[model samples]
Target: MSAARWQRLVDDLAAAGVESSVLDKPYTESVYGCVHHGVSRSITMLHPVSGIISISDRQWSKNPDVWVGWQVFREGRDSIVIRTWPITKKRSDVVAHVLEAFNTEDRT
Candidate 1:
C-alpha cells in the first residue's frame, strides 16, 4: 500500500530539479528498514562536506509523525541523523527546507 504523501514528496523532489536517482531512494542503512525493522523510504543527495544527505521518515510511534526530513550521512561512518521537526507543507516548501538545510553549514 503506497501512500499519496510519499509519492507527492517524490514528485516535489523531481519537480524541484533534484535528480531522479536521489529523489526516490539512495544507498542508506535505514533504507533497508533498520529503524522500524520494517519497510521505509529514503532519498539521498550528495553533500559537499558530509558526503551524503538523506531525507527519511519517522518510525517509532506516530504522535510526532513526520513525512520527510533531512538526515546526516557520512561516508564510511555508521550514520548520524540530524533532527526532525514538524513537517507538513507544500512540495515547494518542503523542498526548500531540505535544500536550505543541506546548504547550511554548522560552524559550531
Candidate 2:
C-alpha cells in the first residue's frame, strides 16, 4: 500500500473515533511476512473495552467483502478479523455496526 493510502485509512479510522495504532515493521513483518513492505500497511483498532480489530496488510481474506467475528470458548471473543476490502466499506456503516456491538449491555 502507498503511504498516502495508508494515511487515508488512518485518518478515516481517527475520524470514526476508533483508537488505532500502526503496527511497526518488526511486528508486521513477523505477523504478516508475506505482505507488502516499504509503507505502513497494518494497524490495530481498539474499541475501548468492547473489542479489537486487526487491519492487516494482506489486503485479502477468505471472505473478501465482509467482516468476520470469532468467539472464544462459547463466549464473545469481542474480536473481529477485518481485512482491506471491509475497511473500504462505508465508514458510517462500519462504525454504526461496531458501535452497536460496543454499546450492547448484554454479551450473552
Q: Total clashing residue pairs per candidate?
A: 0, 0
Give lDDT per model, in order: 0.53, 0.45
Model 2 misplaced stretches (Cα beyond 4 Å): 26-40, 60-108
Residue lDDT tens for model 2, 32-85: 345533443456544455445455443346633233321111113444332223
**At residue 106, what lDDT does model 1 achieve?**
38
Q: Distance (Å) between predicted and true CA of 59, model 2?
A: 3.9
lDDT of 2 at 19: 62
lDDT of 1: 0.53
Residues 14-80 of candidate 1: C-alpha lDDT, one tens digit per residue: 8876653434333334433554333456666766565455556654345334333433332322344
